[model samples]
Target: MRTLTRPAARRHIERVFDATVLDVLNSVDLVDLRVVVLQGGEQGGPPAIAIICESLGQIDLGWIETGDAPVAWRAAAYRALDQSLGRVLPIYGYQYLFDEIAMYYWDGETEDDAARQSLIAYHGADADELENMALPSEMNARRPAWMIAANAAASKRLPTALRRKLDTLDRASKALGGLESERNAWNCDFEIIQDYIPGYEECSSLPPLTLVPFEQFARELDDIARNGMEMGFMDIAGLCPLPDADRIDDWFTALRRGVQLLVAAQDLIRLDPTQL
Candidate 1:
């Protein structure tokens, strides 16, 4: 039998917690549940629920019946999941206090047709192509230009300020088009995969767990946090640093702008699995 180290044990526990959240989402009738991962900056990690929005903002009675009161129930659900997982799992070395909100939508017969069409259009294959082609990985690696085009179309419908920000992002995407092989560009692609599809499991034929220990992990979470902080400060500093003010103001502004763009893009992208 393999001996599980503290970190290994903690990871197993975290997986269980993640699995639990997946179960809850899978069983419910909620159209779509968004799960945002929250992460802490330091060793004393602060874990919190980032956001939870239901489809059409309808309250599901099944969710509420299971000890989830109607009042601020989203936070309550997060706390319940946190407490349950914390009790059974050891969370060490998972210092990044990020909360991943898994958006789960109800799967139905309608989804089958959409999935078929998406598979045919994207890979020139049908459902059986799961064995022949790694569609998700391919799509994730090099997102279709159509996706951004769709986003651009949607952004035009937004308010003036947000539309301008989306236009800037479109420009940025265009500027970076041919440079996808660059380190920074690849990082951006990976970040999107991590953010939007946190629990994406590779096909069964592939290795089950790809996550590595802290020392073995390729990316440094702390470095990412520090870089984000620094970038924020520099943005606030603008062309010249202020005499006495903190430099993160510009960073926050940029962050807000980026978020607005995402919101606008989300509105444009039909997230419906059936829509594909």
Candidate 2:
């Protein structure tokens, strides 16, 4: 039931990204950096990561002679760095600001904090960035209100499509284990539901019925019921610490919502046999 704080999640991404960038930088002799670090964004601004290097002492490169050594390194490292951080950032619930290996030089003070930071500071002007808005990280912030409806069983009953999907998921959960009660928010079965339907994880308000062909969705559910839970154990894990009482309170704050999703698949399947 414990949720990750923004600061903690941001730090996790930063650490992972720094390590990945350094490994990429060391892969080639063209780039020699004294220090590399990640500076997190302010209020959802893009994160700035820089690999500060004074000179490429070992390489006698045509590009260095042309004053495009950093540009060459960025071109070589862009794909590797992007793939690495793309895998890391989302798991911590933050957007990946597409940043790259940029160059800055300091001859007098390699170790001075203020001097080193001067060139890398956020300028409030955009440069050396690629804009890719098509893909967003899956682990972005969750909207608790959307996933668990406010009054699912009462006057604010969810649309038929959501209720139907939830019912299907509730059945698939039976194929494995499940959230035994409201006490268990970190249940593996529920996690499975979240996995199969990203709308649940992202708390996206998109209509569930149209996202995938119902027949395929139902087959996946049956396949999971037959096979997913056991394999899920290998990948799906619980939160580090245990859930607290407050989590339990939040779990059932809207009992009506819980009821809307708990209907039996047998009953639901009867209404529309195609889903099965």
Candidate 3:
């Protein structure tokens, strides 16, 4: 990223285009005798080269007057210039030229040339292939904890319904003492059943209660399970908000019908009737 002001970028493009025109024209001898003689200052130069240069020069003048140039040639010229400069240019200047000058009908050129050149100049070569290259080891390294926290904060700006759900989940987890248990057992190797009672309570409380329908609840649980398997438990922990423990008993009672429906479906699908 070489930072360039708008005017500077435009001037750079104009200069490159002018140089290309001159380079093409200088190789011919269609110009006046004085100009042709001037081009022959070096020994062993072909006269035909002078003629071609002059012809190209005249063509370039006409192109400048009409504000148009051949696309393939323009692309080649720009590519060469980009390679020499070793920096990306702003897309605005190219877009301006394409809209203003290239879109109109011009002598000896089609709009496709201008469009193709613009595309190449903006997108560069084979972006997909370039993306396939492996990232640096440093980029793959774990990010700082603060960065993770900041990102989580940014993403947590949920709609009111989702926010209430999250609040409910938090209260449920707190009532079940999940957070405290995790903190207490942080450094200990002990696997205590009491520590997991909160988790069981949280799940038990989530059934038919809350705004989430039974089918939606099942989908969310499935999503949590899949996410956990792929990204780890911590990543999937927030998939479901904590339910309200105070309302769990009533909620579960209300969901009995849904539960029975699910159980019936499961029983019907079982290979053996006894398995139900």
Each prediction's Cα lDDT score? 0.30, 0.28, 0.26
Which has the higher TM-score value, candidate number 1 or candidate number 2? 1
The TM-scores of all predictions, comma-separated, are: 0.19, 0.18, 0.16
Q: Tell me each candidate's RMSD, in Å, in order.
A: 21.0, 25.5, 38.6
What number of backbone clashes does candidate 3 have, counting pairs of residues 3 or more apart or in separate chains?
14
How many backbone clashes can be found in candidate 2?
Answer: 0
**Candidate closer to the true structure by TM-score (higher is better), 1 or 3:** 1
Model 3 per-residue lDDT tens digits across residues 160-205: 4323433443333233333222222111111221132224222311
Residue 75 accuracy (lDDT) in model 1: 29
lDDT of 3 at 240: 12
Q: Write the per-residue lDDT of candidate 1 for residues 1-276, one digit (tens) a residue.
A: 989999999899679756755554453332333444444323323332222323221122232123322223222222222222211111211212111100011111124344445556654675666455423233233422221222233433444543443355454333333222221211122233333334322311111111112232223333333433333211110011112223224323332332333333333221221221
lDDT of 2: 0.28
